[model samples]
Target: MKSLVALNSNDPELYLLLRHILEAEGYDLRLLVDVEDLDHLLKVGRLHAVILDCTPDNESSLICARLKLGGQSTPVAALIPSDGNAQYMKLIKAGVDEGMLRPLAPSRLLQFLRHQPNGASADGELGVLAEGKSLRQHVLEMDLEAQRVRYNGRHFGLPPIGFRLLACFLKSPNRILSREHLIAAAWRDTACVKQRTVDIHIARLRRRLHAITGSEMIRTVRFVGYVLQPHKNTRNPGSDVFQRG
Candidate 1:
């Protein structure tokens, strides 16, 4: 069964509508009334995607941010009020997969769900995404299966958390990954880790990659998070060098 996480507080009508729509399409829906409930549900569920109802009182953006931080791979779709582009931007920065306006049409919800990864049970998992095999110095290439880093033909093994964090940056090169997203990607299960834990891992990854490539492979955007910036001379205009998610 395809599991889901829905965030909306006290809107029985909205919940009922979603239940009917999703049940008809053969989905097992899990309703989340608040952030705490959503956090609890995520621990035991292999979710497909999250449907966030963006009512004025519904803090869907914050909730989605927390879920993304917790390593939940479920794609998030935010339902905003018609005039709520500001909220939409916030959701996007929080790593939401898509956004729609309320009252949500059943067809739209189904459309978003259809595009998500079919999970491992369907057609096998999505493999490592790469632009090409030949990686240049200072550029990032991930072995998604082995969680190894290959730069300038040298290999550097990564810890599980570091690998996940680097994968987030590789998947979205040049985009600023906020500290919240990094934390969600690195330490999603526990809230006890110091916020500096992300910094520690990033620093370690940076040093290791630099040592292997003999160049600064990762750049830190002040007040923002890290990004993988390839050397200008190494870029191939026609060749696929950097992979994008």
Candidate 2:
């Protein structure tokens, strides 16, 4: 399931632009223009992040106050005028998790929503992301703590590299990751492993997932890469509501 992000902005033009862009990044969004609407969404406690337009004076402070009042740890980013440092400090003191300069760039917004610090985009998060197994279901579970995967009441341990490769797939569900991308993720850039090494590891990883779950979760993309196929009925209600009524 994708994360839910609320955009509370005063600018209709910018709001419309951000809506489409964020939605494309796989977020469930709620556009809130009214204070009452923002309050309601915060109280619901389902929002993972909030994009607040600081165009109006004190609006950022009020929004941050409301989030604090609701006692939810939801992150907030204030979109302010790019002219001065005055508004920047105001938004920072108002408790916004991040601040963005106007004339928004695509990567800036993406990094803000994804909580990437130092302007680090998804491309830089390759090997760092595949260290865990947070997405598990459909009678198959990958436990990072135990370094083993469980399926059909049986436990299996993947080879060291195989585990890393599977963790990479688990981190990147539904995204087409190329063989080169997989190689970069599972192995350091020492130029030692060839592209065929990635294929071998993928084949082994698929066998592990299939042996346990009885379903192939990874799919090949001819001339491209691979993607993790999710279960038919599995959905994270916390993040995704698409599969829900």
Q: Which stretches of candidate 2 lie over 4 Å from their true place?
A: 43-45, 116-245
Global fold similarity of model 2 (TM-score): 0.45
TM-score of 1: 0.51
Could you tell me which 10 consecutive residues in candidate 2 have the lowest summed lDDT? 117-126
Candidate 2 global CA lDDT score: 0.62
TM-score per candidate, chains pooled = 0.51, 0.45
Q: What pairs collide in candidate 2?
A: none
Error of 2 at 208 (Å): 42
lDDT on C-alpha atoms for all candidate structures: 0.62, 0.62
In the range 1-245, model 1's lDDT, one tens digit per residue, is: 55554545468888887888777776767778778877677677667777787666677878888876665656677776767767666666565655566666677667556544453223211223333432232344665533357764567655445556677676666678877877666543333334555666678678766666666657888887777775565454553445432
Per-residue lDDT of candidate 2, residues 103-159 (tens digit): 666676776555421111223232374344343544445665444566545877554
The lDDT, on a scale of 0 to 1, for candidate 1 is: 0.62
